[model samples]
Target: MKLRQLASECDEGPCPTVWTIDEDAEHVLVQGFKVEDEEALATMKMPEHETTVRTPMALLKRVAREHLT
Candidate 1:
């Protein structure tokens, strides 16, 4: 599947970012820091195949304003 970048928090280097998958506009892929908080992890029923990341809300808001609309 192809990825179309929707938003990025930084101009260079590793940072929180968002992308659209193949031609599906309804769903998106996010890249951010890995979630390593033990207390937070215990609240979720995450599967072994799935993992989560941590990012600022501004990253999501930027994508929603600039790309989702």
Candidate 2:
């Protein structure tokens, strides 16, 4: 699948970013800091194929305003 960058918080290196699937605008791909908190992670049951990341609320709002809207 192709990807189009929607927004990024960094210029160089790994940072919270959002991407849109070129083939489907209804869904988005996210890049964020890896969540390694054992206590927090243990609170939920996630399938082996799925994982989680952490991002800021401001970034999410920006995505909603610019893309989702």
Candidate 3:
């Protein structure tokens, strides 16, 4: 349960890998995962305020921005 910054670059939908977005849909949680695997694990979620990512990084960097707060 951590906040992960996404790369500005994306390959579009049906990508080989997938990102796990938060409940707010405002940020990424982890890098990428196989599509099949992602669905199976999507049931688990972290409480909003308690969410945290190890090796902390900035979430507002322009390289990867999440505007949905």
Candidate 4:
């Protein structure tokens, strides 16, 4: 999927690391910055493997529905 479309689906905040049409892919990428100095935010890379894996929105909705009742 296109970056803009992926971006649109996200909640209002910083951009996500990885946007994928297939959530089951090997990795879920996210875009972020590293604060080398308190006053400076430099663009940095955050690999999916480096952090906790998150449930995709589609999956979350399904799970919510299953237990909501």
TM-score of each: 0.86, 0.86, 0.19, 0.24
> Which candidate ranks first by lDDT, i.e. highest?
1
**What tens-digit string does per-residue lDDT give for candidate 3 at 18-51?**
2445555654444333234334345545444543
Q: What local lDDT does model 1 show for residue 13?
A: 88
Clashes of 1: 0
Residue 68 Cα positional deviation in candidate 1, in Å, after optimal superposition: 1.9
- Per-residue lDDT value at 64 in model 3: 42
Model 3 Cα displacement at 34 (Å)?
Answer: 21
The model with the greater TM-score, 2 or 4, is 2
Each model's C-alpha lDDT? 0.87, 0.87, 0.39, 0.41
Stretches of candidate 3 exceeding 4 Å from the true structure: 1-5, 8-27, 31-51, 56-69
* CA-only RMSD, every prediction: 1.3, 1.3, 10.6, 9.0
**Candidate 2 structure quality by residue, lDDT tens digits, 1-69:** 999888888788878999999889688988998988888788877668988999888888998899778
lDDT value for candidate 3?
A: 0.39
Tens digits of per-residue lDDT for model 1, 1-69: 999888899999889999899878678899999998877787886778989999779999998788768
Question: What is candidate 4's lDDT per residue for 1-69, written digit by digit as tens?
Answer: 433223322567654334443644443344444334422222335444543333346544543455344
